[model samples]
Target: MNASRLLLGSFLFALASAASAATACAPTIDKPWVRSAPPGAKSLAGYLVLRNGCDAPVTVVDVESLDFGMPMIHRTVEEGGVSRMRPAGKLEVPPGGELRFEPGGLHLMLMRPLRPLADGDVARVRLVLADGRRVFAEFPVRRAAP
Candidate 1:
């Protein structure tokens, strides 16, 4: 009957729309920022919130920045009243989940700046994933908190 045919057509259209939306979904970087260091400082820290909107997990294998020589993921560890920072190697974000990089916790160690960065400067960085996907984001440089 025509009524059944109409219902089926609507269902198919809805399914197609959902599929298209899913394909359009991509990982996003939110609130990206970098800390301004002293004039002679060699290294600095970057922070951001990475969100995974796809259906599969994404692994951030490496990070690169045009302003810095080598950027790496690091975690702060505290034990016996002492705090230390260590490389995290790689980070994974589950589907529909997010990873937060903040001070006194997970952060990006940007080393050996090619040029000095000042407050209000924007730093461009790329997040390389294991699946050969690269996500680019611009981080605004902010003054270091006192």
Candidate 2:
């Protein structure tokens, strides 16, 4: 009986260690940037490339930023020659795969700035995952893609 209990405890410890290791290699963001808007603009757009290196899939449930009052995942769609922004829910990145946030596609819709952000400024953003893990990045404000 004592040996069985010891084995179970060891298994639990290994499971916790594996969870920590997976988060340590969480998805990485590349080329994170916020499109530069005019001074006093009410809203802006942000873009990034997410590359998942974890052994399991990663699902981004929401976006948040201290620089903006409302940060969300949005996608641009066209209908009847008109373009519209729609909420994109739960973006998933497969293991060893990549997801992109580009213009006219999956992108960040940041609204109601806390302060005016200009070219060469930085916006701190956080991507909240479904498993309660958060990935953070500093997106530079730029007029063009880089």
Candidate 3:
């Protein structure tokens, strides 16, 4: 009787694992990282590359982080010889396309961390898409570039 119960549990676990794997989104996240900030800093920035392997467009509507008070998508634009940061409402990735968030360009503005995040720490973020798909990515915190 114990053996039979164990086998049943294993089968259920396998079935659930397969279902979760199948439901995961097709967009692959690479090079996810956040810039290290000083203690008591009000905000920090993160960057990453998102590659869409699906045949249809993927729209990333929101970003959320448990460690931070707010995670917002932003872009740095230069106008009139001045650079300013602006909120990026939504970013869309085309089929077989790639979106890059880099320095001096698009980035994730992580505001009001619950605790101080130093270098070598990992921050988990969730990406919410327009199609009701939620994907997670871990961003490693690194020292700022000199």
Best by TM-score: 2
lDDT of 1 by residue, 67-144 (tens): 899888889999788999988877999999999999999999999988878898888888888876788999888986
Report how far off residue 45 is in candidate 3 (Å).
0.2
Clashing pairs in 2: none
Candidate 1 Cα deviation (angstroms), residue 43: 0.5
lDDT, residue 17, model 2: 99
Please list the C-alpha lDDT of all candidates, in the order they appear: 0.88, 0.94, 0.88
lDDT winner among the candidates? 2
- Say which prediction, candidate 2 or candidate 3, comes out ahead on TM-score: 2
lDDT value, residue 119 of candidate 2: 93
Better by lDDT, candidate 2 or 1: 2
Candidate 1 residue runs with Cα over 4 Å from true position: 1-24, 144-146
Model 3 residue 102 lDDT score: 93
Q: Kindly list the per-residue Cα lDDT of model 3 for residues 1-146, writing each as its tens digit.
A: 99999999999999999877755647888889999988889999999999998777899999999889998999999989999999988889998999999999999999989878999888988888887787789989998642
Assess candidate 2 and give its TM-score to the true structure.
Answer: 0.89
- Ten-residue stretch with the least lDDT total in model 1: 18-27
